[model samples]
Target: MKHLNIGLFGFGNVGRGLYDVLKRINSDNVTIKRICVRNIEKDRGIKAEFTDNPDDIFNDRDINLVVEVIDDAEAAYDIVKRALKSRIPVVSGNKKMLGHHILELIDLQEQYNTALLYDASACGSIPVIRNLEEYYDNDLLCSVKGILNGSSNFILSKIFNEKMGYKEALKLAQDLGFAESNPTLDIDGWDSLYKLIIITMHAFGVYVAPEQIFTYGISTMNDADIRFAEEKDRRIKLVAHVEKIDDRLIMCVIPQLISRNKYIYSVEDEFNGVVIKGLFYDKQFMFGRGAGGHPTGSAVLSDITACAYNYRYEYKKRNDSVLPRYTTEHTFRVYFRYKSAEQRNLLNFLKVREQYTSDEYNYIVGDVTIANLKAHQEELRTPDCFVAAYPFD
Candidate 1:
């Protein structure tokens, strides 16, 4: 077997972590042939040979493997695609880019006969992708729900568990390097949406866009909402969920109330957990340190290790032949927080479960159809309004 002569791309935190990890374990078998970065002037810590050209890595025969950890979605896709075309095995941690271009990449893998593994794209250190690809390929998955984004989970944990204010929680997350300066991607639920799309692809071999699947973040919560969740013995978590409803799937990334008894309830503060409910295997919880350089680096290294064995995700359920369609006809109870009656009236609920009112603010819990909520998502996502789904049993 040929040892991994890696052509690394992007020497950011994850890229640097990958290099650091490779040196500690199995150093003799793998070597980073080149490190590509946009800013060659800045200090990158290591003394490795660096370049600004994409072709330097792709065209190098010694560099049989490629790793991308950049921020740009379109550029990352282009580099990964080029690497596949070059017959080089690729590993990436770019979930947003992957989620958008995965179908195309799958086709590229088939056409080029090269492996492209991205274990780090979904749940940080959790091995959900590989497990879905290898273990649950044939099993009937009833649902897969979890706290997918570490930043969101961290904020919610502080609010519910420690009684910290929303602003303080967000600042703590940012200070701890769990959240970016512009935290919309994490707090607005786009991060979870990306991961959910990737997870759905591996689990059910289904492709659902962020728009098609319902998404509402935790930016709309108040002290009252937090109190309500506490009253119900539940914690508010940004849940990335996909469940089988009859023949179709209902996928959504929303801040939902989950019971304290559930495993996901305790998964807090930059930690991640996933509950995969299958027919044979009741509810399986996969927990891990979800964010930061070390955990995500470990996941990136996992994919790199598999690349040494010529391993690629054999998507048995998905191919050029067929794929399942997504449907949002399911029912769930939602909590809508609004400042005005207009926002409340805009909501199309099947039945109002409860209503609370005050001079300062108002909220209502009601049974809602996914279709109705999605139809009015624009109005619901405004500044003064907030929406979240709860465990409806």
Candidate 2:
């Protein structure tokens, strides 16, 4: 049997969980050779060789596997790039790194004859990526969308269910380790956007630049927005979505109003759910714990074990003759809330569905192009404004 000596990065939640899980599995041939951390003196609750130097793992040719669970995207990219260049298989949970540098990383894998598996990056424990790559590879995926970020979802759930304020719910999510080290990533929709970019590769076999997609977070959402949702018999959720409209694909991550009858309406806390629509299979829903140590660790472990057989993503869709073109020509009916008329004037609404005004709150429900939203994303993210999909259907 070939021994799989692993070099691990970042001994935080996911890292520690991977360690505990590896120990539980009792894979005698699989052993952690060394752990790399920013601070080596921090007590990690296990007796293992730890180092701050990246070369410790890079120089040790005996280490055939690298597991990177670090929070830093640029740092993780460097580590992953080096490992692949050395012909080492890597199992990563860094969505930000993969979202930004996946094309280059995949190229590296092909060049060096190594594998990169990151099932833990999106929809933790859901196995969505593998299913997209294998099970749905041949199927015509019409759309893939749902609650992709658990931290943001947790905050939304708390606000709607417990009547907790957004800031309170967000702080609670951070305290429970559901939110990322930089809460801005989760609350501001960048985390979900990053994961969405990764999923688009597997789902559509096309690489879409993150900048092209408009993302609006829940940080600016106020009680008026929540009350509006409540009055309309809907719940607010930070949703990441992509879909095909003829030959074009539209994608975005933003706070959306979900009706009660939807599959994802009940998804709460640190849980994730995805709805996939295909031409043949129709609609499929997948639900699982989306964040935290143990659940994500289980996902990482699956990827690690798959390395035993040297499995890698085939990216079959990329090789497809015809691929869907990502476009911003799509228009969606959305509810925009703002304190001042000037803020409301920022968006060019194609059609007005409804309008409400008051001293405390003012909003407009109207049709707005994806391009218009992307153009005014900075203004939309201001403290006085919040936007959500207002699909009445």
lDDT of 1: 0.84
In terms of lDDT, the best-performing candidate is 2
Candidate 2 lDDT score at position 287 = 99
Which regions of candidate 2 are displaced past 4 Å? Answer: none
Candidate 2: residue 26 Cα off by (Å): 2.1
The stretch of ten residues in a row with the least summed lDDT in candidate 1 is: 316-325
Q: Which segments of candidate 1 are over 4 A away from where they belong?
A: 137-139, 319-324
Candidate 1 has what TM-score?
Answer: 0.95
Q: lDDT (0-100) at residue 185 of candidate 2?
A: 93
Q: Which ten residues in a row have the lowest lDDT in candidate 2?
A: 133-142
Per TM-score, the best of the predicted structures is 2
Encode model 1's per-residue lDDT on 211-329: one tens digit a residue: 78777888877777787888987878889898865567789888888886889888979999999998887899999978877788889988888988888898876652544558888
